[model samples]
Target: MNRVYILLGANIGDPWQQLAAARLEIEERIGSIELQSSIYESEAWGVTDQPVFLNQVLAVSTAYSAMECLDIALDIERDLGRVRLKKWGSRVIDIDLLYFNEEIINTERLKLPHPYIQERNFTLVPLVEISPQYLHPVLKKINKTLLLESKDTLTVKKHIHEHL
Candidate 1:
């Protein structure tokens, strides 16, 4: 089985509920969830005008290939009512493939070890919570180290309420 890390975020239409539903769909369609981080509340990363997003990181094990995992994630996003009106726009669900095992892959459709993992606290914070020692394939740094070195000024707070 290939280990994959996925980031799930939502800012529109009951984000908590949307994440919960997405988790179920992920387990059913993508892979079995091995580890899940607590939900985080963060300011919009790229676009500051949007609503704060609820984000979480999940570690999953699957027999599917990386591209297959991407396809399943997109399907889950669409099934959860995601409408990509704009880049980084508010949505009901956003499922991002963060890492696929320790492999580095760049294709027209997918990129492994998510290109932005090192730059976004919204992604690194929760990721560290669940996999602090996990090493980045390309950066050769642990998740905790990357989070500590992250320059992202955005506020990322751990949500007190449990949604995962």
Candidate 2:
């Protein structure tokens, strides 16, 4: 089995319900979720005029390759009403493939150890919560270190505490 980390974000519709539904779809379509961070609420990253988004990082156990995982995640978003209106536009659901094991991959459709991991507080905080020691394949820094070094000033507040 291959382990992958994914980020789920939503700012439209019932955000909590959207996340729950996305999680279910991911488990069914992608793989078994071994670990998930508590949902974090933050201001929109790129498009600042939009509503706040609820985001979470999930560690999944999958048998699929990186591109396959990306395909499945994109399908889940489409099934759950994600539309490409504009860059960083508001959405019902957004799934970003953050990391696929320790392997470094770069393709037109996917990028491993997501290019923005070290720069976003919203992505870093929950990632640290679940796997603080997970190292970035390219940067060679742990999640906690990335979080500390992050220049993103966005205030990411934990929305729901997870038991596991």
Candidate 3:
């Protein structure tokens, strides 16, 4: 099984419920979920004019490959009403693959260890909450340490909402 980390976020139409719904759908498709971080309330990252997002990271073991996993993630987002209007646009739900094991596979659609995972505090904060000592495949640094030194001071509040 391939160990994968997925980041979940939502900011529209009962954001917390949408996030939980996505998680339930993921469990049905991906077998079992290993670990999940507490839900966090974070200010919008790129597009500041949008609503604040509720984010969380999850650890799972799956039989699918990296690209296959990406396909599944995208499907879930679409099923949950995520529309691609613009880069960093607001969405009802967003499912991002943060890490896909140690494989460094970069294709037209997917990038391992997510291209921007280390840069955004919203992603890194909850990621470290689940796996504090996890090491990045290419960066070779602990997840928590990266969060500590990150220049992103965006407010990331823990336990923003209770998990369903």
lDDT tens per residue, model 1, 13-73: 9999999999999999988999999999999988889889999999999999999999999
Determine the backbone clash count of candidate 2.
0
- What would the TM-scores of all predictions be? 0.97, 0.96, 0.96
- Name the candidate, 1 or 3, with the larger lDDT value: 1
What is the lDDT, from 0 to 100, of the residue 36 in candidate 2? Answer: 93
What number of clashing residue pairs does each candidate have, in the order they appear? 0, 0, 0
- Superposed by TM-score, candidate 2 places the C-alpha of residue 68 at a distance from the truth, in angstroms, of 0.5
lDDT string for model 3 (1-164, tens) is 88889999988899888988888988888646999988988899988999999998999889988788888889988988889998897889999898887778788888888988778999999999899898888889889988988898789998634445
Highest-scoring model, TM-score: 1
lDDT of 2 at 38: 93
Which has the better lDDT: candidate 1, or candidate 2? 1
Candidate 3, position 93, lDDT = 93
Best by lDDT: 1
Model 3: colliding residue pairs: none
Looking at candidate 1, what is the lDDT of residue 54?
96
lDDT of 1: 0.94
